[model samples]
Target: MKNILIFGAGSIGNHMTYASIKLGHKVYITDKNFAALERMKKKIYPKRYGKWNKNINQISNSNLNKLNIFFDLIIIGTPPKTHIELLNKCKKMFKYDKILIEKPLCSYLENYNKLENEKNLFCGYNHSVSQSFQKFLYLIEKEKKQKKIFISIKWQESFKGILGAHFWLKDEYDTYLGDISKGGGAIHEHSHGLHLAIYILKKLKIKNFDFNSNIFFKDMENKPTYDVASVLRFSNSKINLVLETDLLEDNPQKKIIFFNSKTKIIWHNSFTKNLDCIDYQNKKFKKKYNFKKNRSSEFEKEIYHILNIKNQNQYNNSPLNIKYSIEVMKKISRTLKNAKHF
Candidate 1:
């Protein structure tokens, strides 16, 4: 059992704490809002995660400056805007071999170069570790080359659902969800499609690429963060990639398609954990592949993998590691800059 310290007790933070404790590890969580910590304690600690013998403690942000404790791993689960600042704080206060930061890593690239090359640092791109996605990779390896790839994602869900699921999202306007500067948007939040596309290309050993995007923001009160349809295009000498993201769709959908001139493969994965794939050629061949439910399994497996890392070089080369995320973030930055806005 490892002693873990988690900064930020928001949605992702709470989940990480629960995962750590469920795996029989002690967790010390820190948050600026004491009320949020108390809510997590009541909501998570005693019902679904109570029976574990491991201890769970909440440390206020003010007290973090005074506490001196060594943790096996430190997870930065705050918003994208706060990651770098909190990370700098943890570096001073803790001695840890591994650090995991929640997705999007950081909101901006201004200070990205200042970050150290820490081999023990990993980002939470859990989709890269999903069994279904791995199987998709394995299946696609049989093809000599992919001529084109297309992905469409619709991440529409109710505000009430968000509030119910993540208690910290009660005040939608105050939370990071309503602020574009803090990495709020369909592209930033539902970025599994973007990362997975990059992951697939990297896994297939295709590197030369260029990205183009057309994005639009929702005209709402307070701040107008983009929630409407957006088109992201990626191209290289070998392939043409097209991906679309939308948070305003009435019926949500998530899918990916890989095709050459003659053959095409489609993977349908939305709310359902089923990875239903159909491979076909117009009149010659058609095949259907079905995978079982393995959503929660990815998080469990990712935790196991992070804890077992012993080499810095290995982490640097990991798909879910900071190096790749930095590269992906750079591409995203480019896409945003060149986006065609309405």
Candidate 2:
């Protein structure tokens, strides 16, 4: 059981804390917002596992100077703007081996470069860690061997305020969208798509591609942050990604549709949290593929994979995943600039 320290009390932070305690680990959570910390404490104490324990500590910019405890892992879960400051503080307080951060790693290219120089640090893009997405990739790989492919994603945001801001805000929203200086907009949010695209292209050895995005959100500082649509063109493939993040929409729909020249395929969440894949061939024969749900039972599996807890499958390269994430960020930066002008 590792001692983990989490630095934010947001939704992802809460989930990470829950997952860690469920694995029988000791967790220490600190948040500058006392109210958020209190709410988290109340929500967590009643649901904790028998072997698990947690301590909620209040921290602030001034009080942070006194914190000296060395934890097995330090998770930075704060917003994008706070990343660099927190990273610098962590570098001074703990060894590089102890840090793990969330998506878009550092908020800016300069900060990312600074963090890359640190030794023994492990930063990951958590979306790729999802069992559902991994299974999706596996299936895509199998399909690629058989025929040419095309992909389409319609990410409906009827529930716009929930997970939407957490992931998509950096990409489509105004406050962060076009502002490369501050890490705003779709590339930040939709970067997972970019990463997945690049991963598939590399695997399939596809060379040529084109990307286009239409931005409909402006004045993001005082308004809702969301995007209209973005499109991608690859060798023998074209992907249309529609993001409906407007606050005016009452009922939001989120779905991903993929098509080969011959058949249409739909991948979605199942009733049991597993992934459901349906294949339709010219409205004639339909087949369904239900992927086994490993995320729930295998929460520790990915962590163990990352930590090398046992003899696990080693990735072909040590930092390939991190490099892929950085590449996606670069693509996102380019996409954001184009979207801002349009």
TM-score of each: 0.85, 0.70
Which run of 10 residues does model 2 get worst, by summed lDDT?
309-318
lDDT of each: 0.69, 0.54
User: Per-residue lDDT for 1-342 in model 1, tens only?
Assistant: 788998887677767877787678888998888987877777644444454333778888778866677788888888887887877877877787788888887874446655557667888888676555666677666664645554333334434545555654545566776665677666666676777777777777777878778777776765646444567777877777777776665455666777766666666663363443444343487777666654345566678778878787667656678876776567567667776321
Tell me the deviation in Å of residue 53 in model 2.
5.6
Model 1 spans with C-alpha error above 4 angstroms: 44-54, 65-67, 144-164, 167-171, 270-296, 340-342
Give the number of colliding residue pairs in candidate 1. 0
Q: Model 2, residue 219: displacement in angstroms?
A: 2.6
Alpha carbon deviation, residue 89, candidate 2 (Å): 2.3
Residue pairs in clash, model 1? none
lDDT of 2 by residue, 215-326 (tens): 4544556664444345544444444333322223335433445666656666553424454444434456766666565333344544444555222224433332455656
Worst 10 residues of 1 by lDDT: 150-159
